[model samples]
Target chain A: EIVEALIRGAGPSSLEGVRVLLTAGPTREPVDPVRFLGNRSSGRMGYALAESLADLGARVVLVSGPTALSMPRVHERIGVETALEMHAAVMSRVADCDLFVATAAVADYRPERPADGKIKKSAEGLTLRLVRNPDILSEVAALDPAPFTVGFAAETERVADYALGKLRDKRLDMIAANLVGGERGGFERDENALSVFWPEGSRDLPMMSKTRLAAELAALIAERYRERHAAST
Target chain B: EIVEALIRGAGPSSLEGVRVLLTAGPTREPVDPVRFLGNRSSGRMGYALAESLADLGARVVLVSGPTALSMPRVHERIGVETALEMHAAVMSRVADCDLFVATAAVADYRPERPADGKIKKSAEGLTLRLVRNPDILSEVAALDPAPFTVGFAAETERVADYALGKLRDKRLDMIAANLVGGERGGFERDENALSVFWPEGSRDLPMMSKTRLAAELAALIAERYRERHAAST
Candidate 1:
């Protein structure tokens, strides 16, 4: 109990008694029985964020994709493989959450017709038709009494501009943007820096370990969430 | 030194002083900076095989794809991400080796033109044009003084037929076939069963832990390798 209290005091515990829905990792889109379309996300950042939110006394329900990471000590965890499965998992439970954070790098498109068997290398060339997947974040934000929605943007270029556009277009309460495909911290790395944006202002969190960064981001999120509630009441 | 002798005595050390070129894990074909076409190989079997071969006193050069597995104790490990890279690494080293084992589930096709930047999710649908990758196993066996080549066939159905066809078609000395996409013993599983075939005969290795299976398979490989050399002499 003392240890828990100390941890709570270290960061803003304004999220006490709040329920959070968090999604992490990259979703795989099947091409065949063995092959799929995947990404480089290691799920370290989002898993650390889940722990940080739980430390601030929030009840965290984590929806995860296929990752090598062990489950975090959150209230619950729902494992899904594809974007469709993740969307279903989140939509089924988002009604009870006080906040929603989408950190999953869900596939934008999936093979339109996945082969039932393994494809043989008989052809000289092949063409795969892909169809767009549903936007999970936009759907959650469109809820009648939506929770304080937060989105994450991983861009190779124009990080801030893309993040701001997402924040405005998705009607999210906040957005965290980061540059990927660089030598520095990003996917598959333990450390990262994020540009956080809200309706009124924005802040830059410097490069640091994902664990430390998560705690700081959690504190900022708590402050903004409290202020939004205060304004509404 | 004592431990090494004990390990060698436990299994056939017939491979002592032999040079081996082996490939393991699934190669990733990049769709873009962030997304890739990947398979379900976990690299456990191949890594275990590398250790088992090393235990028998062979100098193992492992050309591997991206895997979460730690580097196995071997003479050398060449890490690669794509099928083309793996092919280059193997082809450059195969001439110096006496035995070649192709265990990697290399992609049959890669995107014809991979995008320079992360592709935005603007279109409702997209078509990806893929071109066939170089057949690494076939090329290795086609060498004038080709080493004793062993291939792996991962099939969802007709396991034995495919294994034999590949063995004959690729002119390989041996082929190990296993069923994937099943409920038991295949890709991503620590335990597996292999149907090993040679020109004269075939053997069925029952389901067991990959480590033990590797040791058994290595012994069989050593026996066949010696037989082929003696016949040639």
Candidate 2:
């Protein structure tokens, strides 16, 4: 049992000396000084991945948004805010990486113009112009030196079909799909369930701790990374 | 614009009075007075669903596990701790529901004998005896008055194969699949990616807030529920 676990833990030799880049948490799109658009992301999942990657002896760069969580050990932690900042930080370091994972809940759209002062609500309803934010994963995957890019798909329906489309449309090497229905495990909760899809095969890890799932995903990513690397070579 | 939004929301008249029962958050299995095996599940998804179901005027019963978040408006909330407690609660109420969604991260195994007293540290490593916990979704689906059941498959790889298998094997009407990996969002994060699959058609909701996804899912569930109901009649 110990030996089997060890084998599973170590993964393949190709995983050695690889570099991993991950983005985590939620991006805050400012509407006003007092109010901003943000999700319930706590950054726990990203922290778990950073720890898991480090445990596997991979050099990891964890680019995080504003999160209350502490930084994981044995990795380079870059903190930023807004989707633009995250995209810049990731782009600066992505060239030197071997694997790229985008886990941040980046705002798909942002206020077109920032309110110079906090807007006091009128008796009438208010309206604010919005513009699309940067597509970080799609941008990275489109790069010439694109590392094995992985994207995340959070859907409520037709998760697999959409994931496959993203995998093809975004040109991602793989995608991790999840259902967002229950409040606890999907966001700001400590546990999660994941369905990972790749070009060849996919597997289910069931519902487990973000910590345990992160480690399991790291092992599988290493394995798949090696397989893809070998086939390309 | 409000009227237009309402019209967009009320796509046809097929989903008027659906009733839904959902489970969310993590279940704790106690081993001692102060110690228990539990994951970090926040219950955001289920609360979001409850909120959406209410918005669509569906009578909703949300059987939840322990969490810090407040209950979503317009739904009945029943909180539980142990798996057995959750099982009993779900079984008691599941029969009348028109749709059932299971998103709770229930523990797969529990300590065989929960120690009454905290074990003192010794030189030898501690060993624990574990027993399998009941599959809540499967059990509910097997019931005579089983509602339109939806289960979640969180996998690391082989997502579709495993998810579709579960949809058939567990006899679920549909399964929401998620892949857990580096940070973007899964398990305690703010956003999630989902792939919802059934025997025929499937769709995907891209990474978004669990709240928004829940609204979309509730809509889909309501539509599917009506279709299934009509087919049976």
Candidate 3:
């Protein structure tokens, strides 16, 4: 009821003519011809956000990694694999988008040099040399005329502190923090809860289907975006 | 054409009344509440095997990991996550199966103690302590009345030597070896090739859709199985 009211209050045109860019799913960093580093992101939340944002009249450009999700109803969808590919995709189009959402659960590292052939298994085991992946959100935040950036911190522990740290460190305008796993919500689940925070204010969103949560978040983001735009003007 | 003939040569009773246990897809080993160790095994080949085996009159019990593919037409489909879960699921049913196919890309190691809550990200980085998971195929091979086991070696390099070594070391009745990744084959692609190896014989299966490949492989396994049974009798 609370979230529904929030959505109803925003009205359309809150994001009319606004262009939004979103990232979703887990990036695959190849270890060899057959293997790769990946996370357990199902891309549901991100897809929902794309749909909700589009519903609010934003032209959504979705850059997604490997997932089973059908394409969201959006202006465009750019498919990618590794973090490097995603970084390239997002940076090339940042200047055209008004609001940016980073919902992807990107791997932090990739094999420094993926083998041309499969590595043979040894009884003693094998070790991989991994290198850090570029932080996409951080890069976007550093842009000269950056979009209104909202990032996600899907944490299992110490949710608030970490989310806040990312908001400050990455210079994000807002961050949505959530816990994954368990019956109520998490990876691959249909329902979720979020704690949204900005520099000066915060709101706790109760557990709900990713669809409804996205609708509410889209509305809230639109309101904040319009307020910031008006103040700047 | 050769592969099609191979399937045509096998009679309908090739695997009749055979209770086959198969494992497919890639296991998820949790690192934290929101993160896990996973690989990209689409379960395409395994699902194909299940369908083909069922068509040959085997009672197929498929234990699979997380995948985007739909359930194969088989006697039963048991979904699981993590190496531990897969191990347990396969072992519990080993008593009832006459033949076993180990196709799942089970993670060799898993986080020793996955965090109950999401781990906080630090600029410094994060490390996980992983422990070796039980070798499902090895354990099944050691069973008192072991099923005639077939294993898979999905390799990028040294495919033959490694697969043969596993065939002998694990006491497997047969092993299917394949190279992953390229224009015509490997992960996510619809087609593949395999080198089938047994104790004293080998057969090279050329590139084809996983559907056709599964049919040929199923026929070969059934023939080998019947021959072994006849000799024993």
Report the CAPRI category for model 2: incorrect
DockQ of each: 0.85, 0.01, 0.41
Kindly list the interface RMSD, in angstroms, of each predicted candidate in the order they appear: 0.6, 24.5, 3.1
Write candidate 1's Cα lDDT for B1-233 as tens digits: 99987776644447888999999999999998899999999999999999998988799999999999998999999999999999999989988999999999999999999887899999999999999999999999999899999999999999999999999999999999999998879899989999999999999999999999999999999989988888889
Which of candidates 1 and 2 reaches a greater lDDT?
1
Best by DockQ: 1
- Model 3 C-alpha lDDT per residue in residues A65-184, reported as the tens digit of each score: 989988789999999999999999999999999999999998887777888876544444355556678899999999989999999988766789888999999999999999766666
Q: Is the docking of candidate 3 incorrect, acceptable, medium or high quality?
A: acceptable
Error of 3 at A123 (Å): 4.4
DockQ, structure candidate 1: 0.85
Q: How do the candidates rank by lDDT, highest first?
A: 1, 3, 2
The top-ranked prediction according to lDDT is 1
lDDT of 2 by residue, B1-233 (tens): 99987876665333447777888887877655324555545778777877787787778888888777776785588999878889999989887887888988776656678765433333232444557777899998898878889887665556677788889988999888876534656666889888889888898878998888888887777777767777889
**Which stretches of model 2 miss by more than 4 angstroms?**
A1-233, B1-15
lDDT of 1 by residue, A74-131 (tens): 9999999999999999999999999999999999999999999999889999999999
| Cα error of candidate 1 at position B205, Å | 0.6
Error of 2 at B203 (Å): 1.1
Give the TM-score of chain A, superposed on the true chain A, for all candidates in the order listed: 0.95, 0.92, 0.93
